[model samples]
Target: MASESAANPPLAGKHILLGITGSIAAYKAAVLCRLLKTAGADVRVVMTPLAKQFITPLTMATLSKNPILVEFFDPENGAWNSHVSLGEWADCYLIAPATANTLAKMAGGIADNLLLTTYLSARCPVAVAPAMDLDMYAHEATQQNLRTLARRGVHIVEPGDGELASGLTGKGRMAEPDRIAAFVGDLLREKKKSLQGKRLIVTAGATIEAIDPVRFISNHSTGKMGYAIAGELAGRGAEVTLVTGRTSLPTPAGVERVDVLSAAEMYDAAVRAFDGADGAVMCAAVADYTPESVSETKIKKCDGDMCITLRRTRDIAAELGAHKGSRLLAGFALETHDEEAHAEAKLAKKNFDFIVLNSLRDAGAGFRGDTNKVTFIDRAGREELPLMPKREVAARIADKIEKILK
Candidate 1:
């Protein structure tokens, strides 16, 4: 196990602050600390005063190789345990086996304990694993507190549904140590600032073609994939400019959004933003053609079919490609047939560094879905990916972008 852990240390050099609250499940914190240590993380344990009854500080300190912190100051020596300093040192703060009382206190901003005070001062991502009886877990107050914490960007590792300490066979069991360790590792991995100081442009959603005042033509794009990419890049410390068409999705954090209603407007916005961008992801489902002339007013129902001449819209990707020069340009191809061939052609024609290809025939690979199955096509070759959440896909894309930027 030691050799295996050394071979795959995902959290190497990461500083993890582990918080243990009062609960029978506090016993699991020792195992969690060991697992985190095995994964090459520097672990520090902080315990609530009430937690000492269930788990000994000596055990945690032995596993973590760090002194246990339970109080603000040591009465024996008058040395201080600075919560602010601890908060700043940790890459991530994890509260495992968090009791209902601890959850409530965290949600309410109560900082009576050293762990709670550290949580309040921590600037890093915070995660909690709730553990309690089924009744306490299912109560509306608890649920509301969880929701409130979630809205405040707290990562919640939901309790498992199994035998509880209360002798009831239901939900509200704290997740096992292995799962908690994996969650912390994954969370810290995603928080890496690989693209820091880079500037990126991303286009998203379906561009509309207006035929009348109240009627317009658009595709089924919900901007989920593009928004995910923007969020991923921003999370990696990139300055992102999102040139978006019509979509109800909220702007991703740390991304500057430019909203447009039509393909022409989107083309203008994207082109302008790309001038100062280091790279661009063309993910918008832009219209190939738009009405040459729109009606002055709403077109009433007519017996004969109405005819409106259409003209091609400006190709945003091709324009960006022409001016991309040394900058990276990535585009998406949503195809019904000959997916690879079309993607490759577009990759060359638009001078894209690579193209993401998705076939309409594949289930969950198209627009309006939270999941996607995609293949990356570049001059080197192709890399196919399995169907997964849009966020994961975005991460993969961001990883590739980082390689190019580096």
Candidate 2:
């Protein structure tokens, strides 16, 4: 029996149902099963009939220490393998090497095989790591199927970009076994209802102010930080409204996204969302100014330099702060100089419960990066955090939010 303790990993004592499909990536399933077992999980594998051709069941069964199931009934004994029982027995059902075929079947609720049948009956959280050729993975149908599964609360362990079996170099490779295992572990670890019953507004990305049909002004904010924060909040069971500017990032799981282009549009959406929200995280790098008059057509180069007047755009955080009555609010300040002082000032000025500060001078702690180093400033004091991934930073911010709400 697995023991539960801080020393024990999150997957300890967890029941993991591993699903394998027909793909060249099926060979990786053996390593994945071993990794899950090493993490203290009791793993049982279910495979599609076609998958056995790529990787043998004997290999997986040895690693998992459990019999591999591929059919509904035992041929010799005539005893049925209950899909419903398998689904309910597991804590999480993870389908690695999820081929385009399997994804399509899952999206359409077509359960011709034991794996698909078990997937349909799974009461626990489901995750998939897709593997296919670049073109097939990029197909509209496959993308739609992935989107459908995502919308239905299925976790997607996004495939990596690399050489494909088709001699093409691009995305569609299944994530490595270690990464997949770690993702499952993290999912289980953070799957708590800390922020349950709370509604939150998270503003993200850089708002684009149009100067003309073709010309516009925008910042380098990729909306990553805001998206991370939104994901963290949603993961913690908060009802999140992500008011975002133009960004290529997909909407985070369990978040309701409101797309806006200009600062005015963001202001409108943020204000509307904040009306009923328990709090708001002002993470967007909203444009401070916009062209006074947007030209009807693109302005052509003239002999001399032409000037465009600029007007102050709405201050979303300040406006929301004015109306924040006993509500929790958080703000972010990315500064080049006097970061702590500036953050403290904003904390008071915006009526924020706390303000997160990061300096551009700090390497790997700014826009467009996956990591950040931050300082949390509040009336009580300041807590400086070491450089960490944006997701971890978001979790820390959520932790502070939880304390404030309490």
Candidate 3:
């Protein structure tokens, strides 16, 4: 069960794909299905056959108003149920009580069932709440699988610690249905209220500096923070234009999204939106330089090696800073040495009103986690925020933007 406070419910008019796998907590999927329906989302459930051993199909079918898909083809007429079509149909894909076996399959590319196939084929953001015995979850294999899935762009809803079905418990309990629903609603609804009437632009992910047709240099950003910020802003009320590099992240609600591959493409998108935008958050880790000349085709790997010359890409931040007076411009700096000095220098040079400085050395602050410990530095001074989830960090950024445009 979630704590005392209930999140605001605003998940109306959204299509949610609920994937149910085999686990003891499968029964809770029914209640979760109900909660989702009550909150205004269109729910559809796809279950692994083993999942039916715990929860009846009729129960989920009644709540979702859609036939539960379990097999690739119907046994009667062999009518096909395409996973790709299902993936594209939903705004978000949710899997509650995800089992250890399923997680392993997901991590290793074992598409033996309809659920796994759909998950593999999903284009929407996938959120999984894993459920298993304490020992099964504590095993190294499980942890590794979770990390692999996370790195592969799957959102793992961390399981709660408590009593388990085995009568021995430390963790691995599935979160309560109401709380799970609220969490999903919060995840989806977070930005709806904040960005409703405003207009903003978010540049996210790592920009590629192509060395040749087949190779490029980039960072390990994965674009999580930037994408999260964009989704949050759109959820709140703002018209968000998310200009993202190559990432598997889905388009957030009520946002006009543009996809790009390189710094040049991202630069083009950012400048065009800044033309009439109220503000912008340059959150991408843009490559500092690009290969001076890209080989038309893959460079042959022959002889000792090769030296590829590089040239600086146009400064997108500088362009916006020059014209961004009444407009609010926010920049993100992932620094290593002389953190504050570098951020402040860039703050002045890039003409950013504020720069979010995160030191890579700091634990849980830099990249690849749901949390961050950051120091927001602007012209006034610096305010160090406690380590918190990236969602909260995004909220603080939104709060600052509200103050600016208000």
Candidate 4:
């Protein structure tokens, strides 16, 4: 394909680390690697010992123009090929033909091999495309492993349903190389240009209110949904500034990140960014109240019970609503009771264009997970979205923004 005729392959400049495991689909990786190279990405190949039974290291090395690393150390001199360095070097770690065994190891944190070790150390995004025989793919163990990896932040490139290696037709075939490349390109592109020209500010995670420097009140908010939304928005060509309270979640690609602590700090950061933003998603679980005053030092644990004074924290959304005009404001409410009534009141009071509501009663959602099932409410009514990956949830929110802005 001509450089211009190639549709500006989104893989260009992506440092893609390819992992080939023991599977019949391993052969397809050669073509996949070549296509990735043609698209202008820097490719590096990693092989499992079993992978050698299917494909030659020399073949992969020649195709990638880089040495292949299959083990932690070279057998000849015992020189180390550091998994840490490999993890640090790549922009993305991709496993094509990821076998059920590898998926189980990845999900279970079994680091018996170099590939698994590198996976644990990788700082960038990890995506896996599984390939297997029909029955093996549909087994309960395999399905559980896949879900475990998904929950642990690994992207599963869903396998296509078709003829399998065992001559049975089912959903075990790895996606075609070209389609996998396209999917990866979309993933990378989603992190880069999808939100261009639109300004978005998202608040995420939980706020910490101090009773003293040594003690603070917080919650179980992982901020996965908020971070995912920020990432998807940035990928779609939006300039995003993420105003967040404390959370372990990494900052999304192509986003300007701001970290805050107490609700007061969050309020300050969010309102400041709202001015320049075309829209804002208030997703952080900010504390409704905080200690009225702080002790100069840690409060000593006494034999008797103690009472502390509490005060209402400034309502962030309401303050923003007072000033936000025509800007698409999105709010999230986690309700345990009277879900609709509370959500509706919040929408009207905060002047949000729409509100996303999820219940504590719902499974696969809330804190510390990748999946979310939500009900999105606009002034018109509600749309109940099925349980979906948080990333998909982000896509839906971005789609709504696109509709409103368009």
lDDT of each: 0.90, 0.92, 0.85, 0.88
Tens digits of per-residue lDDT, candidate 4, 242-264, equal 99988655466567889999999
Best by TM-score: 2
- Listed in order, each prediction's TM-score against the native is 0.63, 0.82, 0.65, 0.64
lDDT of 2 by residue, 81-138 (tens): 9999999999999999899999999999998999999999999999999999999988
List candidate 2 segments past 4 Å from native.
1-9, 22-27, 71-82, 99-105, 108-113, 131-145, 158-178, 189-192, 296-306, 336-338, 360-363
TM-score of 1: 0.63
Q: Considering TM-score, which of the candidate structures 2 and 3 is the better prediction for this target?
A: 2
Please write out the lDDT profile of model 1 over residues 139-165, one tens digit for every residue: 888887886786577887767778988
Q: Give the winner by lDDT.
A: 2
Sort the candidates on TM-score, descending order. 2, 3, 4, 1
In angstroms, how far off is 175's CA in candidate 2?
Answer: 4.2
> To one decimal, what is the Cα RMSD in angstroms of model 2 from the true structure?
3.8
Over the full model, what C-alpha lDDT does candidate 2 score relative to the true structure? Answer: 0.92
Position 397, candidate 2: lDDT: 97
Clashes of 3: 13
